[model samples]
Target: MSDSPENDSIDYGNLMHDALRLLIRNVLTDVSENGLPGDHHFFITFDTNHPDARLADWLNDRYPGEMTVVVQHWFENLDVGDDGFSITLNFGDQPEPLFIPWDSLVTFVDPSVEFGLRFEHHSDDDDDHDPDPENDEIPEAPMEENAEDDTPHEAEVVSLDAFRK
Candidate 1:
């Protein structure tokens, strides 16, 4: 057999994926400590059905495939770590906290700086889509309690279509 780079050796896509993921973790860490500065905000889209994703019961019914969240004005208990991040936001006059692992996240966008990233978290097949089930190895619990306070707040739903043009 001839020695070649494509001789069933390295997975370049997987390597690049991991490197790009690190960028997200770094950005999150900064936000967790210093908080978002100026007009900077994030439009994060993630797989709602991901094993590590913990959202309110109602959200699953609404967004079965994926859900995008705007991290701008109204959010609480923002925590970012090695594995993932968790934050609480108000929806329909109630607190909805969600835990989303890095592996679960499909997109991360910052409109202010025109920075965006899209990760392939799912397979092409309509069926047999196997997401990385990190939960099987590590047990997890909801990060924040359901706050009864009906704080009226809203998160902007940014459309990427505008940027495309």
Candidate 2:
């Protein structure tokens, strides 16, 4: 692809990445408002140290700066606002409060659909100041049991006569 005079300065690659992140955010926001329907579930992972992140002191003590939470049957009090959303979930055995801004979200995964998205935070210059994974203590990815896990039968081999012919 040749860069024209006007197109030379635009970085389309990064722009598309940003767009994809936005799309994921929109999906989450919708889910937050309308509630998850049927078997759909989300694994939301976010940077806990990001300026906009809010968490109970105890949760911070245990999780430090990053955590991945499952949005499932247990979550309650889901309040989504313009800047962020607040939800109450059982942390350990006690209910804990958390507030997470959209910008703080680093990754989102839907195990049912085998889909996910990752985002990076950047400064005004669009240069990423990498998150201190050590300082923030990136949490281990949570394991999700999808339909395949429960139904462990092998695929039945049915001869495809149409293709063979």
Per-prediction tally of clashes: 0, 0
lDDT of each: 0.65, 0.60
Name every residue pair that clashes in candidate 2. none
In model 2, the worst 10-residue window by lDDT is 148-157
TM-score per candidate: 0.69, 0.62
Residue 160 error for model 1, in Å? 5.1
- Which of the numbered candidates is closest to the native, going by highest TM-score? 1
Q: Candidate 2's residue-wise lDDT over 69-144, tens digit each? A: 8887788888777666788988677898889876666666666664555454443453443334323222335422
Query: Model 1, 1-165: lDDT tens per residue?
Result: 647867767756677767777888888788888988898888777767677789987887677767778888888889887788999987766888899887776667777886666553333353753334321121111112222222221112223443432
Q: Residue pairs in steric clash, candidate 1?
A: none
The number of the candidate with the highest lDDT is 1
**Full-model lDDT, candidate 2:** 0.60
